[model samples]
Target: MSYAIGSVSSQDLWTRLKEQFSTVSRTSIFQMKSNLQTIKKRSDNVSQYLQKIKEARDYLSAAMVHFADEDIVILALIGLPPEYNTFQCMIRGRENVISLKEFRSQLLAEERIVETHVPNPLLSAMVADHSSATKGSTSPFQNNSSPSSFFSGGNRQFNHTKQKGRGKFNQGVKFNRQS
Candidate 1:
């Protein structure tokens, strides 16, 4: 080791050894960055997602790639699933930037809310029935006076409505008809 380093002292040799062992390649850095960008919150809780981000961020930091708290927040937001779009928008539209701790707390709260409100079948059915009943009377096709109306002349066969719920927030109710 000293032969290669040209008569380096023990401390210098130790430092050189540490540098050699700890050096990260550009490819490694790029790969870590890519992983950071693509790591998503699918089927994982907020804690898991945050842990992954922290790991990637720590790797980048070890490689001497620094990210500001704002950048970290943005990257974390990008890693979230499509369901978090509204939350992402809310964070982005904030007049004052929040700290990483605040962001984590907010994200965890939102995640909990999302988890709690997921598809209560009984409530969903009630909402669907209510919406359908309201729509039934107000449907333009229900006007028997209109020549183009399918409900005219008691032709109720063509007035069928199919309800399919995907159970994702406001999109939980779907109405389909076969013509």
Candidate 2:
């Protein structure tokens, strides 16, 4: 240790060591910023996305680029995929500026709602003409019920059969054409 100190001053040695082992670099900061901008929820849950945002924010802070809470919130929203487009619009349209805590809570709540949503199978039930099925005659709107039902024909009685494994009971929806 004495021999090493005789060759170099402590200040010069410290500087050399710091130069070689420093964690902060211009390229790393730029990459962190780029990562923050391009991050998406994708397969990650709301909590995981938030954690990534926090990590990037922390990295920026460590690099001496301090960001406000609102800026972080905006960055998080920007990183979200198009699936959250309506939610993003709603948040942006609010009269009062939302805080980071409030935004996180709201986002988590929305994520839970999206995850729990079970599509109603009744909406896509097939419409079979009661008359055609009884008398063995093919009708214009028989076998399928699509959005085009509105333009198909006049008012008719049709049986709504739920697709197999979708539901057990069959229901009826009145098909009405508007003038």
Candidate 3:
């Protein structure tokens, strides 16, 4: 008896494939296909980018909160290049800040500031003074341009530093003026 092996037709092959698919449960195949489709899904949600932007915006807002009206006046006075030693001055018991708009006007009155600029020392003095607890008004310097005034003797911010006292009282110095 001779067996016809290669004589199996294309129809027989299709039947074998159909029988295999039928043996496998349709519900399990559908669940696996759905799972694969879900895993392969791509979306345009920029979650990471949005999170980064939120973090940057939060940092910017925090920086803004640190800036106040006093900071504007301070920057106007001292400029941003040099360091403001307000914290250090407070440690030395000096309590002052270039916070008064009136004070800026007073310097402008003496033509010390070029009608436009206040130096950094004034801001440094103001920052240092702000850190200290004061008991009395720090305004003796406002009385007159005396040799012993804290901010007097004209606008020291614009004065020539005569070598007579190079570092004694050329610029904004602190003094506990007693009445």
Q: In order, what is each prediction's RMSD in angstroms?
A: 13.5, 13.3, 26.6
Summarize candidate 3's per-residue lDDT along 1-179 as a digit string, tens digits: 02223438767665655554455455655554343223210221223322333333333333332234344343333321222234224322525555435534543343322324556897877767644513365443445545444444344544445556456453446567799
For model 2, residues 39-124, the per-residue Cα lDDT tens digits are 88888999999999998887687567788888888888888877688789989899988998899999998898778878666543
Per-structure clash totals for the candidates: 0, 0, 8
lDDT of each: 0.77, 0.74, 0.40
Which predicted model would earn the best TM-score?
Answer: 1
Residue-wise C-alpha lDDT for candidate 1, range 54-168, written one tens digit per residue: 9898778867888888998998998888878889999999999889999999999999878776787998877776577457467444445454442233343343355467534
Which of the numbered candidates is closest to the native, going by highest lDDT? 1
Query: What's the candidate order when arranged by decreasing TM-score?
Result: 1, 2, 3
